[model samples]
Target chain A: MISSLKIVEAAENSGIDQNIILKFILNEWVVPLNKKELTLDEEDIERIKLIRELGEEFGVNDEAIPIILHLIDQLNHLHLSFKNNYCH
Target chain B: MKNPYKILGVKETASLDEIKKAYRTLAKKHHPDLNPSNKTNEAKFKEISHAYDQIGTNEARTKFDQGEPGEENSKQQWSSFYNTQQNAGRYANSYADQFGDDEFFENLFHGAHQKRRAQNQDINYLMDLTLEEAVLGVEKVITLANGKNLKVKIPPGITSGTKLRFAGHGLTENSGPPGNAYIMINVLPKAGYIVQGHDIETELPISFMEALLGAEIEVPTLYGSVNLQIPPNVSTGSKLRIKGKGIITNTDVGSQIVKIKVVLPKKSDPELLKAIKSWNGKYDYNPRGEK
Candidate 1:
C-alpha cells in the first residue's frame, strides 16, 4: 500500500526543479522505484528536500552531496535496525 | 531573533560579499550534514543560515534595516523575491499573475499577511483505524492544523500503510496550487483477527468432542457470524476457508481462514478415564510416527 509519485509530482512536491531531480537521479543521489516511469516514493521526496537544503541552505557543493547522502543512508539503516532490536 | 549582523559577526555596513564570506566560514564549521554527530552544530548552523537569509540580498538587507522583524520581514522578502522572479519571466504562472487584481500586495504591506501562509509542501497525517473500521468502510472527520474539518471516506478493506491523497486540500500557498494532504492509515492490532493482505485469520476453539465428532459451529466474521461445519477428526492448526467472507475491497473479495484449535475437557470423567484405561495400548495411535 505504499504510495508512489511520478517524477513530475515528486519535483513539484519537493519544490525542486524537475531538471534537478533528473540530475539527482543521474548522479544516483536518489534512486527511483521505477526507472522508466521515474516513480518516486516518499523517501525519495524527502531525499530531494534534503539535497536541496544541503545545496541551497548549507551551500554544500555537488561533489560533497553524494558522500553526505550515503552517510545519511547508513545512519538511517543503523537507526532502523537498532530500533528493531531494542524497541520490539 | 538576535541581530543578523551580530550573529554572523559582520558590521551593519558590511557588504553582501563580506556577509556571504562570513556565512560560508561559519556554515562550513557548523553544517549539520558535515557534523552529523554533533548536536549543537545543527542549531548554530540554523542560526547562521537564518542570519544569512535575513540579510543576504540587498532587498532583504533593506527590509532588515527598516526594523521590520519576524515573519513579516520574511514574507516581504519572499514577496519581493517573487516579484523579481516574475519580472524575470521565471515563474510563468506566478503569484503575481494569480493575485494581480486581488489587492493581495496592498494587503501584504497593510499587515494583513497573516491571512495567508506560503506553503508548498504536502502534509502527512497519521490516521489510526481499528480492524473493523478498516474492513468496513467508514466516514471520518479530521481537523487539520488550519482548523478545517475534512471528511474522509475510508474505503472498504483498506490496508495499513495505504495513503489516501486529498488533492488541493492542503495548505494554501502564496503562488502555485495548494499542496496535497496524504492520510497514512495505520490499523491497530485487533484481539481475535489477524489481517493477512485482504484475508482475515482467526482461531476457532472447538471442544475435543467436537473435533472427534463432526459438528456445526458458529464462527464470527467481520460483517456477521457464519456457521461452519467442523468435519470429524479435524486437527489443530487446520485451516478452513470461508470464501468471500473476509474483506471486500475494490479489486477483490477475500476469504476468512479459520484455524482449528481443539480444547480438552478441564475435568476428567470417571467413565471416560475407565474406558481409556481399559483400552490403553490396544488402540493406541502414534500421531508423530515415533513407533
Candidate 2:
C-alpha cells in the first residue's frame, strides 16, 4: 500500500497538483489499490509517473490526459500488441 | 532523492504561489520541449520536473518536511520523462555541449530549465516482413531507404500493419532527443496459407472420391503438418474453423481457419463414364430447386 504521504510526495515529485492525483484516482486512470487508509499501490504509482511524463513531454494539458490514459488502459485490457523485451 | 526544493531551485520556505511560479519558470526553461538537442539538459529537465512534482504540492511538501519517501511521486516524475532518444534524436544532438556538460549539470543542480521536448519533432518509418519470417520469428536486418541498417527481432504472432518502436534509431535526432524508428509491419502474403487476423486460412484440393468417401488429408501449417478430417458428402466448397490451431497471438494463443475444395477428375474410366452417362441424360435432381 502506498502511504497517503507518499501520494502527496508523488504529486510533489512530479510537480503536479494534488487535484491531478485525485483526478487520476477519480477517473480510474491508475490501477486499483488496496483501500486501506487511502494508500495507492506500486503499479498505480508507476502509471501515474508515466502519465506525468507524457504530460511533461507532450505539453499536454492535464485535462486532456484522460484520453490517452483511457486509451492505454483499453489497450492493456485488450492485450499488449508490442513485442519487446520481456515479451513472450 | 534530494530535497525537492533544492531540485527545482526553489526556497524551502517558498510559498505555494512562489513554488508554482518557480515550477513553471523551470519547466519553461529546462523543459525537454525547449532545450535543443541536448541530452544533458534533457536529464536536467527531468530532474526539474521531479523536483517540482515533489515539493510543488502541500501534501508532498509536508511529506518531504516529515522525511517520508515519496516513491509514488518519484514514479510520477518518471512518467513525465521523455525518451529524448526517440524525440527526433534531440538527445543525440551535438549542440548540447554549447553549455558544456559541467554547466548543464550545474544548472540542473540549480533548478533552472524549461520544457523543450514536445517542440522537437519525431520520426516514424514503416517496416515490412515476410510471412515465413513473421511466423518463425526471424532476425531481420532491415536497411532503411536512407542506408541505415537496423537489426530488429521479429516476434511471432505479429499481424499486418503492426507498428514497432526502436528507441534512438530514426532518421535524425534534430534537437531535443533522438526519436524512435517505427517499424510498421507489412506481412507479405504466403503462397498457400492465407492470413486473417490471428487465424491462418488455407484452401486444399480434395478428390471427389475422397470427399464422398471421407478421408484424412495432410495439410501444412506454419508449425508443421496436421491431418484434417474430410466429412463424407462434403460439399464442393466448405470452410472449417480450427480452434487454437492458428497463428500465435502476442500472448501466445493459437487460432486457425481452413477452406476445402472438392475437385473432380478431368477424364473418367470407360465403365465409370458409361455409368455416369446412364444416370445423367438427366436424373431429375435439383439440389438447389424447391428442395
Candidate 3:
C-alpha cells in the first residue's frame, strides 16, 4: 500500500516547531523511507499528522517526552534480554 | 478501521479457529442481551458486529489482516506529552476549556505561542482491552460524545498496560498544531496465561507416567500450542522451554516459559496396590527424601 501523508500534514497544519518533527524521525517512532525520493509514504504522513494532533490535544508540556521514550526503549530491550536468559 | 479481527477481538495473526473462538466468547458477553446496564457494551456489540462483518468472510479478514491501519481517509495524529502545567491554559481544548473559563488557552495556543508550539498537548484517552487484544494488537475507533471519531491504529507487539498515542485530533481545532490523544490501555487478564517479566508462563499438567517416562505434551504459547518434549525421569515442577515462543513486544521479542505440574492418580486398583506395596517394600521411596 502507498504511504499516507496525514502525519506530516498534521504538523504543517498545526504549525508546530519543525524540530519536534525531526525529533520523531530521529527517535524511530516515525520512519522515513527512500530519502532519495521526494515522495513520503502514507504511514509517514499519517503518523506525523497524528503526532502533531497528540501534542495539541494533551498539551503534554514535558520536554521529557523523548527521555521517556528512550526509557521505554531501554526497558523493552532489557526485558527481552532478561527473558532470553531466564529459564522457566 | 474495518478490521474484523478487531470486532471478534482477535488479532490479525489469529487463525480461523482463534477468530471463531474469540467471536463466540465476545458474542456471549457483549451481545446486547447478555449486557444491559452498559450502553458502552451495546455500542461495542455494534462495533464487533461491524468488525465481524469485515473479517468473518475469508476474503475480508485476509485483506484487513495484511493491510496497514488507516486506509481510505482515516487520519492519525499524536502530540508528545510535554511538561507544562502552567501552559495548559493556553493549549487546553477549547470546548473543554470553555467550562473552566481559562483565558490562557483562548489566546496562547490560538495566538501567542504560534511559532514555538509544534502541536497541542496530547489528549489522554483510556481504552480497556483484554489480555488477548493487548498481546496481539487491535484496531479501534474511539468516538467522542461530540461525534468526532478517531480510528486508532494499534500496532502489533504491544503489551498489557501499554500506552498508544493518536496525534492532534483531540478537542483542538484543525487549524493550529493539533494535539495528540494518549490512549492508556488497560488489559484485562485472562485465565491460563501467566505474564511475568516478558514471559507468558503457564502450568501444563502432565500425567505422572508421562513425567516419569518422558512424553510429548502440548503447551500453549502466544503463537499457539506446540508439542513439548518432557524428558523421562523428569520431576514435577520441571520447566520446558520453547525458544522464541514467548511474548512479542513492540520494541523487542521474548520467550515463553512452561512449568510442568505432574499429576498423580488419586486412587489405584488392587493389582496396582499390590505392585506398589511390593515396590514400596523394595525401594522405600520417599518424595520428601527423609528431610
Candidate 4:
C-alpha cells in the first residue's frame, strides 16, 4: 500500500489543520521524509493525530507537546526493545 | 453530579475568588495533559472541571443558589483551565524563550529554521546467557526498536549483571546524535557445574568398587572430558583439582575442582551381602565412636 502522504493529504486524512501539521513538523515531533516536499509516512500521520489529541482533548500547550512526545516515544522504544529481545 | 461546592471543597457561600482559587488548585493538580499516563488523574480532572463549570461564574453561582441546574460548559471549562495554566506562569515563558512569541510562526516557516542540538535519550535492555556462554565468549544478534539487527560480542568470563554498552545504538533523533544502548547480562547456571569466582566446582559420581580400589576415570571439564585418577580407599566428599581446566579469561586462568561421590547399589545382591557379612566380624570396626 502507498502509505507515504504529502502534507495536504496528511492534513486531509488526519483531519488536522495544515498549519498545525507544519508546526508539528517544525517541532520535529513528526518528521517527514523531505522537508522541502513535506512527504510524511504512516507513523508521521499517527504522531500528528496524537499531537492533535494532546492539544484539543487534553488541553496541552505547544511548549509541553514536545516533552510529552519525547517521553511517550521513549516508553514505546523501551517496550519494543524488551519485546524484541525477550525469549530469543 | 455530586455537590459542586463539596467537590471543589468550598462552602455554598464561597466568594468568586475563593471558588476560583479552589478550582485552579484542583484543576492544575489533576490536569490530564500534565499527567498523561494516569487515567485516574484524567477522570479527576474532568470531574474537577465539571464542578468548576457548575458554580464558576457569579451568574452560575446565583442560578445554582436559586435551585436551577448550573449549565455544564465542558468546552469552556478546558479553555478556562488552559488559560489558568498560562496565567499561572507554569510553562508560559519557555515557549517565548525558545521561539519569539510574536514571530514564532514566521520564524518556523520562514528561512529562520535554525538547527539546534538536543541531548538524545539512552536506552537499557536485559540479556540472558548460559554459564558456558558467559565463560566462553559468544556473539549475539539483538533487534533494536528501529527493526535494525545489531551484532554484539560478549567477552569471556563475564558475570551476571554485566552491562555491555553499544554507542549510538539507542533512539535516533532528527537534530541530535543517537543515544547509547546498554545490554545487561544474566548468566544462567549450568546443571552439573557451580561457578565460584574464577573456579568451577563439579560433582563426579564413582562406583563403590572404584572408591575401594584405585581407578582412572574420565571427568568433564570446561574444555573437554579428561582422565581423573581416584586414589585407593578414597572417601566420599573428596576433592580433586584439575589445573587450568575451568574458565580462561584475558587476565586470569581458573581451575576445575571435582568432588567425589561414592554411589552404592539401591538393591542389595545376595553375593555382596554374603561377602559383607563374612568380612564384618573380621573387621570388627564401628564407624561411629559409640562402644
Q: Tell me chain A's TM-score in each of the predictions.
A: 0.89, 0.58, 0.43, 0.89
lDDT comparing candidate 3 with the true structure = 0.56
Best-to-worst DockQ order: 2, 3, 1, 4
Per-candidate Cα lDDT values, in order, are: 0.71, 0.61, 0.56, 0.69
Each candidate's fnat: 0.00, 0.05, 0.05, 0.00
Tell me the lDDT of model 2 at B236.
Answer: 66
lDDT string for model 4 (B78-129, tens) is 2433342233222232243443334644564476775777758888989999
* Interface Cα root-mean-square deviation for all models: 20.4, 17.0, 17.8, 22.2
RMSD of each: 22.1, 21.6, 21.2, 24.2
Model 4, runs deviating above 4 Å: A1-88, B1-116, B284-286, B289-291
Work out the TM-score per prediction.
0.45, 0.44, 0.46, 0.44
What's the candidate order when arranged by decreasing lDDT?
Answer: 1, 4, 2, 3
Indicate which candidate wins on DockQ.
2
Over 4 Å off in model 3, which ranges? A1-88, B1-122, B173-177, B250-252
Top lDDT hit: 1
Question: Per-residue error at B259 for model 3, in Å?
Answer: 1.4
Cα lDDT tens digits, model 4, A1-70, are 2246788777665545565576566545666756688887655665566566666556775446767865
Per-residue lDDT of model 2, residues A37-67, tens digit only:
4455445555665665565455654335656
**Stretches of model 1 off by over 4 angstroms after superposition:** A1-88, B1-119, B173-175
lDDT of 1: 0.71
lDDT for model 4: 0.69
Clashes of each: 0, 56, 66, 0
Docking class of 4: incorrect
lDDT of 2 by residue, B184-256 (tens): 8888887888777668888888998888798988877776778888888777668776665666532224456
